[model samples]
Target: MDLLANLVLGFEAALTLQNLGYATLGVVLGTAIGVLPGLGPVPTIAMLLPLTYALPPESAVIMLAGIFYGSQYGGSTTSILVNIPGESSSVVTCLDGHKMARNGQAGLALATAALSSFFAGCVATVLLAAFAPTLASVAFKFGPAEYFSLMVLGLLGAVALAHGSVLHAICMILFGILLGLVGTDITSGGQRFTMGFSELFDGIEFVALAMGLFGLAEVISNAGRQDDRQLVTKKLSGLWPSRADLRRMTAPAVRGTALGSLLGLLPGGGATLSSFAAYALEKKVSKRPRDFGTGVLEGVAAPEAANNAAAQTSFIPMLTLGMPSNAVMALMIGALMLHNIQPGPQVITNNPQLFWGLVASMWIGNVILVVLNLPMIFVWVKMLSIPYRYLFPSIILISCVGVFSVTNDVFGVFLMAAFGAIGYILLRLDCEVAPMLLGFVLGQSLEAYFRRAMLISDGSLWVFVERPLSAAMLILAATIVMTFFIPTLTRKRTEVFREAE
Candidate 1:
């Protein structure tokens, strides 16, 4: 009854004329951006980060969150149509989604992705509404020491869960930490690595960094690709799945949702990790394991569902516990802070409207996305028909313009271009940028907590272990790190960490 009443209230909040308009706008823009290859929500959201200042807080957040999941849907469009994944999590979809396209089932692939995302989003929103308060309550018990240890554990899990050479990922994380330290020292008044620039005092702007690294860099890299190869012009067929297809996909979707929802509760690589985990699980459980990579619908559906669910549910820790496990969530934390809403265990009791309204909006938003996208499939496919040379230049121009608009400072444009160059270089080197961004975002908070914990203990380091929860987290972190080094455990860890890149 309580849930029903809150949901009714949520509907009242969601159905408002202003909120509905924002929801529509968000799904539309999110789909448009997601359809474009080489641009993901990170840079786009980061670029638009400044714009949230102008809108009502709930509306802004709803729109931003819409972009996150709507991209999940849009990503598969590119993956199926062009064999180019619009987002990392969609890479697995490319394996089977493209195969389906080749088999002349592009429309089916798009439909599957859209429907799967809509279903998963609905389930995840329910889970988010029901479980958020309980989780927040548990989070309230965490002190600085526990948070610090939890962060450490999160970092370890991220490394263990990420794809690519573990060594390289670690190097990127360390470099990110260094970049994070470039601003000012939290404990001491003296600056650590700022040469003399006043801009360095506040640390590198996350918007600038993210826009440069992910957005601009992707544009540059894509520009260099062979023009003929960049466009996906395949003719599509089969908009509807057969009964057999439905039977195969249903189980994966449900299983993926369960796995994703659970993983979303933990910090770090939640959505991405859950997607990969779901794929591996699907393969393990399938009777026809030999058909794993032959564009099985189950293969496409499972990870797609998992990634979408995890993406939505990742908000659990962020809204409730004030912990952002990834770069995107970190940005959300920034968004909440901008609104003067301190995210923590107390947030649910204090801001029920914000919490429930957001949840309600998510449900409504996903429905809007699915309704809007079905017809837009024709439009998105036509987008592939545009000449690459014409599109690439426009993208670069728009990216530059977007960056400039955000800061209105020429320096920010230069920073974005510089990072774009760096992003391209790292891409060529096969280095993953996600972890670096995550590390950079988390670095400041980790430092603050570390200092606060120390101050409380009068500079004693043992405070991290003196608390039971903190001690347990530290132990978990230690175990995760040690597992990578042990010969017997290395294989399992490597398999778990291996992701599509």
Candidate 2:
């Protein structure tokens, strides 16, 4: 009954004229951006962070949330038509989706991907709604030590589950922490890494750092890329799936949803991991494994479903425990903080309207995606025709403009450019910037918690070990780091991501 009432309250809030408009606009923009190859939500969201300051907090979050999940739906289109993944999570869809398209079943593939994503999204939203409050309630009991330990676990888990070497990821995390420590000491009012610059006094601008690392860096890398994409088919017919198609997709979609929902709750887990795991699971379970990559509808349905489900459920930790599961969630945490609303369990009790409305908007956004995708499919296909030359310059200009708006100063743009160079350098070194970003995001809080814990315990350092929950989390973090060194586990971990790529 309480759930029903809360849902009713959610719908009522989400149905407001202002919130609905924002939700619609967000889905539209999100789908548009997602259809573009190589431009994922990270850079896009980073570019838009400054712009979000002008909007109401609820509307801003609702729109950003739309972009995150809506991108999952749009990525499949690019993978199916051009055999290019718009987002990393959609890479698996290309295996069967493009094959289906080449076989002149582009329409069927698109319909299957879209419908499967929609179904999975709906299920994930329900799971999010049912489980998030309970998780948040549990999180209400956490203190400084617990919060600090949880963050440690999250950071370690990110590296343990990421797509690169654990050592490199650890280096990036340490580097990010170094970056986070560049300003005046919070406890002591003395400059540390200012290097005689007045701007460094406030520390690195979050907007500039994020925009540089993700937005500018992406542009710099993609600016020289050649576009050799050729569409498999321009004319899409048979937009509806057959009864056989539906039968084949239903089971995989359900299974994918279940797997994705669970994986999405883990630290460093999101659409990419969910989709890969789902594809592997389907291959393992299928009776006709030999036909797995020959344009199977189940293949198209499963990963697409999993990625979207995971996209929705990834919000669990971010909203409830304030732990960012991935780089994107880290940005969302920044967004919430910019709005002056602290991320954590208090978000539920202090801002019921925002919480419920955001959940309701997710379901509505999925409905909007289905409506936009099937009938308006041609619009997205047409977007592919636009050349890279025009897109790159425009992106760079908008990013600079957005960065300038953050501080109303030229220094911010310069800072962004500097970070863009750093981001490029890191990219060349085969280092993932995500762990660095997470470390930067969590560094200050971690330091504050550690200091506060020490202050409470008279600098004994045993408080973390003394608390059962904190000790357990620290042990888990240790276990995660240890697993990567084990021969069997190391090989298995490498294979899982390698299979996806």
Candidate 3:
């Protein structure tokens, strides 16, 4: 009953002409960005953050939220049309989705992606409406010590989820922490890590850093790889799937949605993790597991559904609990705070329209997304025909413009170039960047909570253990470390995942 009433109210709020326009604009921009290589949600959102200051908070957030999920919707398009994945969550899609495209079923694969994502988004939106307030209530009880511990565990989980050497991830995290310290120190009344530059007083802008690291670095990397093109040249037919295809996909989509919604709430990995988990689950549970990676519709549907579902549910923690699971969430957190709106249980009660309106907008956005994508498939496919040389340079220019736009400083552009070089080096060396990005976002918040907890407990480190929740979290972190380091358990888990084939 409560959820029903909120949805009604949300519809009322989101139905406004202006808000609807923003939503449309957001989804369109998101789709375009997703179709273009080297652009993702984080930098795009970061670039747009400044513009939101002039709009109504509800409208601003609605637009931004649309961009997030809209990118998710568009990511599969690129992955299926080209071998390139526009978003990290779509990485697994390239495995089977591109194969399906190669087999001249590009239309069917795209249609599956569109429909599955729409269904997942709708289901997740309903879940968000139902549970956000209750979850927020639970989050409100967390004290500084508990929050600090949660962040510690979050950072650890991020490192564990990273694709490469844990040691390198840890080092990158430390570097992020150091970079985070460059700003003015509020506690000590002293400048830290300014390196004697006057502009350093304001600290390095998060927008600049994010755009540089992700947007610019990706552009440079893609530019270097232009000569190596892998795209599907076959014409496509049958925008709608056959009855048999639907029957096969239904179970996976449902199961994937459940798994994704649950995993999306976790502090790290979220959508990306959910996609991988869904792939593994479908492969394990399917009657013919050997059919995977060979253009099976379920192979394409499961991960696509799961990742999109997770992407929607990820808003729960950021909006209701003030806890950010990833860099994108961190940016959203910053945006919410910038609007003078505090995230957590209080938000639902104090700002019902903003809460419910955002929820409502997601459903509407998904509907629009499905309708828009079906007709735009040909357009997106045509995008693949553009020469990589021309497209990549424009992307690099856009990235530099975005970086400079954030700070209006040439130094920020220089910083981006430096990070691009570093990113290229890390790529060659097989180092993980996601963990570093996660650490950079959480470092300051972790430090702030840690200091606050210490102040409250008179510098007693045991306070973390004394608190039941914090203690449990610490124990879980320790367990993960122990399990991963133990040769036997690590081998077993790895073998289990591999056996799903």
Among these predicted structures, which one has the highest TM-score?
2
Evaluate all candidate structures by whole-model CA lDDT and list the values in order.
0.79, 0.90, 0.80
Please write out the lDDT profile of model 1 over residues 1-501, one tens digit for every residue. 877877887788778898888878877777777787766787777667767767788888888888887888888888888888878778888888888777777777787888778889999999998988778888878888888887778777767666676777787777777888887787677887878877678777666777778777777777766645343445556777788878878899998988988887676666677778888899999999888777788888888899899999989888886767676887787677657787778777887777777899999999898887887788876665555567666656766776666667777778778888888898889887877876886777788889899999999999999999999989998888887788877776666555455
Q: For each candidate, give its TM-score against the true structure.
A: 0.90, 0.98, 0.90
Candidate 3, 152-209: lDDT as tens digits: 7777776666565567777888888778778788688689889888777866666666
Q: What is the C-alpha RMSD of each candidate to the true structure, in Å?
A: 2.8, 1.2, 3.0
List the pairs of residues colliding in candidate 2: none
lDDT tens readout by residue for model 2, 238-350: 99998998999999999999999999988888999999989989999999988878998999999999999999999989999988889889999888888898889999889
Clashes of 1: 0
Q: Over all chains combined, what TM-score does candidate 3 have?
A: 0.90
Please report the candidate that would top lDDT against the real structure: 2
Rank by TM-score (best first): 2, 3, 1
